[model samples]
Target: MTLLDFVFRLSNRVFRPYPFCHSRPDRSLCYHRRYFGLCARCTGMYLAGCLMILSFPFRGELLSPTLNIILGTVLLLPGGIDGTTQMFGSRESNNFLRVVTGLFLGVGVVLFAEGVLFILIG
Candidate 1:
C-alpha cells in the first residue's frame, strides 16, 4: 500500500490498546473526528508531558526531591478528585475539564518520576 496508508494502519494499531476510546469510540470526546480514535484526556496529558520535558532545559534547575514530592501531590490531587468523582457517577466530566485535569496529572507524574529517579540514580 501507499506510505500514508501504512502510517494510518500503524497508528491505528498503536492506539488500539486504549480501552477507553477503542472500546467505546462513541463515548470519546475529540476536538475533531480524526482524533476520535484516542481519549481526549489522554491526548492532553501526553501532549502536556512532551511540552514539560521540552521546556525542562530552558526552565531552570529541577526541584529538590522533597519539594517535588509535595508539589507533585498537590498537582495530582485535583485530577484525582475529579476523575474519581466522575468515575463514581457523582457528576459527568466535560472535555475542557478533562484536559485541564489531565495536564496537571501529567506534570505531577513527571515530577514524581523525576524525584524517584533522582533518589535512585543520584
Candidate 2:
C-alpha cells in the first residue's frame, strides 16, 4: 500500500480514522478531515485538544484578557518561532522542542478547523 494506508492501519488501534474512506481521490474524496488519513501525531494533537476543550470548558473563559492572550501564545508561539527561526538561519532547532512545538501547532490547527466547522455547519 502507501504511507497513508500504513498510518491508517497503525492509528486504527487508538481510534477509528475519520471518514477519508475511498478507493481513490475523486469527487467523492474528502480533504478537510483527512477522513482518518492523518498520522499518529496529528491524531494525538487533535484528540488531546478536544479532550482539553471538553475538560476545561469554563476555565478557558475565566482567564483575564491578558492571560487569555498568553495562553494562546503559549499554545502557538513556539511552533511559529521555531519554524521561522530555523528557516531564517537565526538558530538551530532542538529536536525535543521541535516535536513539542509541532504537537502544539497540530493541536491549534485541529481546534481552529473544528471551531470553524462548528460555527458554519453546526
Candidate 3:
C-alpha cells in the first residue's frame, strides 16, 4: 500500500530463500535485501565486485602478473584470516571488520582474475 510497506515486503520476499537471512521479524540483522539479506561481509564482497567492474577502465592498466599476485594475496589475507578465525570459533567478526575485509577480498579477486586473463591472452 505505502512505499515503506512495499519495500519491506519486497525485501522479505527477496531474502526469504537465504539460509542466513533472519526474516522480517528480525530486521536488525537484515541490512536490506535486494542482496538476499546477506551478512555484512558477503554484502561488502558483492558490492565491491560491482564497484571493481564499474571502475575497471580506470584501474585495469595497473594489473600485471606479479603485481596481481602480490596485490591479490595482500587484499585477500585479512578477510581470509578473519573468516578462518571466525569459522574456527577462535573469534567473532563484527560487521565493520567483515565489510572492510570483504571489500579487500572482492577487489583482489577482480584484479587477480584480470591479471590471469591478461596472462592467458598473451
Write the candidate numbers in order of decreasing lDDT: 3, 1, 2
Highest-scoring model, lDDT: 3
lDDT of 1 by residue, 1-122 (tens): 76655544555577766563442444345333433445556656776778887888886656897787788888899889987998899998877787788799889887777777777787
lDDT of 2 at 1: 70
RMSD of each: 4.1, 10.3, 4.3
Where model 3 places Cα greater than 4 Å from the true spot, the runs are 1-12, 15-36
Misplaced by over 4 Å in model 1 are 1-13, 17-27
lDDT of 3 at 48: 93
lDDT of 2 at 50: 68
* Clash statistics: count for each candidate: 0, 2, 0
Candidate ranking under TM-score, highest first, comes to 3, 1, 2
Candidate-wise lDDT, in order: 0.70, 0.52, 0.71
Clashing pairs in 2: 18-36, 20-35
Locate the minimum summed-lDDT window of 10 residues in model 1. 23-32
Error of 1 at 4 (Å): 16
Q: Write candidate 3's Cα lDDT for 1-122 as tens digits.
A: 76655654665566567664433332223323333355567657877988999998877576577688679778989999998998899988777798788789889888778777778888
lDDT of 2 by residue, 1-122 (tens): 77866555555434443552222222111334344433333444555566656755554435444444455556777678876897799986654565467578655654454445445663
